[model samples]
Target: MSDKVVKRPFVNNNCIGCGACIQVAPNYFDYNKEYLSEAKKCETYNEQDVNNAISVCPVDAISWI
Candidate 1:
């Protein structure tokens, strides 16, 4: 029952695992086994936080699909 969005966010290969995304949106972003930032949840509940994470990405990796 996930009210998924048409364009969910994702962390691309360009991610440097800076953990900024996690810091910005802990409920959505997390570190993988590779120590990289990955999207734990793609839901668009608090878009402002997500946008903040996207903007803070040093490598501009996070995006919508």
Candidate 2:
């Protein structure tokens, strides 16, 4: 048996466009037309940065899966 580490980040409808996640990890997060935070598409990963963003979100919108 082995433990799996999930690194992909997800944003829910609760996003308030606070830009906290964008400030913490710009490479992973961006603002849509609605100004909500959304994940960017890329292969290079940064779990620590993403986690930092998740921690700072005021509405608890960002999460890892």
Q: Pick the candidate with the highest lDDT.
A: 2
Tens-digit lDDT track of model 1 for 1-65 = 56555566789999888899999889888999999998875435467778899999999999866
User: What stretches of model 1 exceed 4 Å from their correct place?
Assistant: 1-4, 42-44
Alpha-carbon lDDT of model 1: 0.83
Task: List the global CA lDDT of all models.
Answer: 0.83, 0.87
Total backbone clashes of model 2? 0
Clash count, one per candidate: 0, 0
- Deviation from truth (RMSD, Å), model 2: 3.3
TM-score of each: 0.82, 0.85
Tell me the tens digit of each residue's lDDT in model 2 across 17-62: 9999999999999999898999887665577898899999999998
Error of 2 at 14 (Å): 0.5
